[model samples]
Target: MIRLFITRHGQTEWNLEKRFQGSKDSLLTELGEKQAGMLRDRLASQNFDLIYSSHLQRAYRTAEIIKDNREIKIIKDKALSEMKLGDWEGLKYDDVIEKYSKEYDLFWNKPHLFETTSGEGYSELKKRVIGSLKRIIRENDEKNILIVTHTIVIKQIMAYFEKRPLEKLWDLPYIHPTSLSLIEIDDEKTNVKLHGDISHLENNVKEIC
Candidate 1:
């Protein structure tokens, strides 16, 4: 059996402002750095065999902070990145809602067929994420793995494990930055033990400001 511990990168300036950071590289804020420190302290006791992170700076920096001197094999993958929002990458929620109402509604309200002008659809994102996960599962015999990625990817991973409908992916709980999710994987059984755990940054979860 392989236990997977997944976390979204720490909060960023965009996260603070509730902006769409899809596929765009952004740096973690000061609070985000503090969150990473808190996570490192919280997860110090756990043993991880392999550490995988998104290629984005936020994710890589988060992994670097968490794995400080641990000497674990860390792998970077673009397949685990946040869903690209195309032209909406850095736009604020309210602005996107007002300017691109149709597309925004279709994305947040009905995700099945929503596609941005230059970004990937939810279906395609799911495919790529699951494809990467399958490869990881097949490559490793049995071990604990840590993956640092984005909220959307985390949601899709959990959705895949629960065999839930793709359209209802957003029906799951919200994913906070620096939060930890646990999954148990094996040949016959895939279990989501925990989802969007931000107990490490309990006070900061709502204080993204």
Candidate 2:
């Protein structure tokens, strides 16, 4: 069996402002740093055999914060990076809708049919995320693993495990920053025991954009 603890990366200034970050590098806000520290404190007792994170700064930085004094080797993987927003990178939500109405509309309501300009589609992201999961499963053998990644990446990974089509990917609950999701994997089955859990957070904790 394999135990997986998956979390979305901490918040960034763009995230706070509800802007699309895509693959662009963004640093964590002060509140995001606090979130990471809170997570570290909450999960200090949990032992993980392996730690993996997206190559991006935001995700890896969040992992680094949680790692604290632990000696686990951190593995950076491109497969866990956020979706590439292409021309839409760094744009605000409203501007994206006004400027690229067709693309924005399709992305929100019918993601499977939408493709970022010169970028990957949801099916491709699903394939990449599942491929990464396969590799992690084989390597983990029978151990606990932690993956820190972006919202879309986590969503795609969850969709793959739920055996759902890419079109219905967004149907699942939204995964917020610093939220944890637990997965149990056996040779014959993979189960999502929990999703989008923020019980570790304070009552007034700010939501990720």
Q: What lDDT score belongs to each candidate, Candidate 1 first?
A: 0.86, 0.86
Best by TM-score: 2
TM-score of each: 0.94, 0.96
Model 2 segments beyond 4 Å from truth?
none
lDDT of 1 at 196: 81
Query: Per-residue lDDT of 1-209 in model 2, one digit per residue for the tens?
Result: 99999998888999878788888978999888888888899899999888999999999999999999899989999988888888788888989899999998899788878976566788777778889988998889889899999998888888777887767877857787799999999888888998888888886665756
Candidate 2, overall lDDT? 0.86
lDDT of 1: 0.86
Residue 136, model 1: Cα distance from true site in angstroms:
1.0
Pairs of residues at least 3 apart in sequence or in different chains that clash in candidate 1 = none
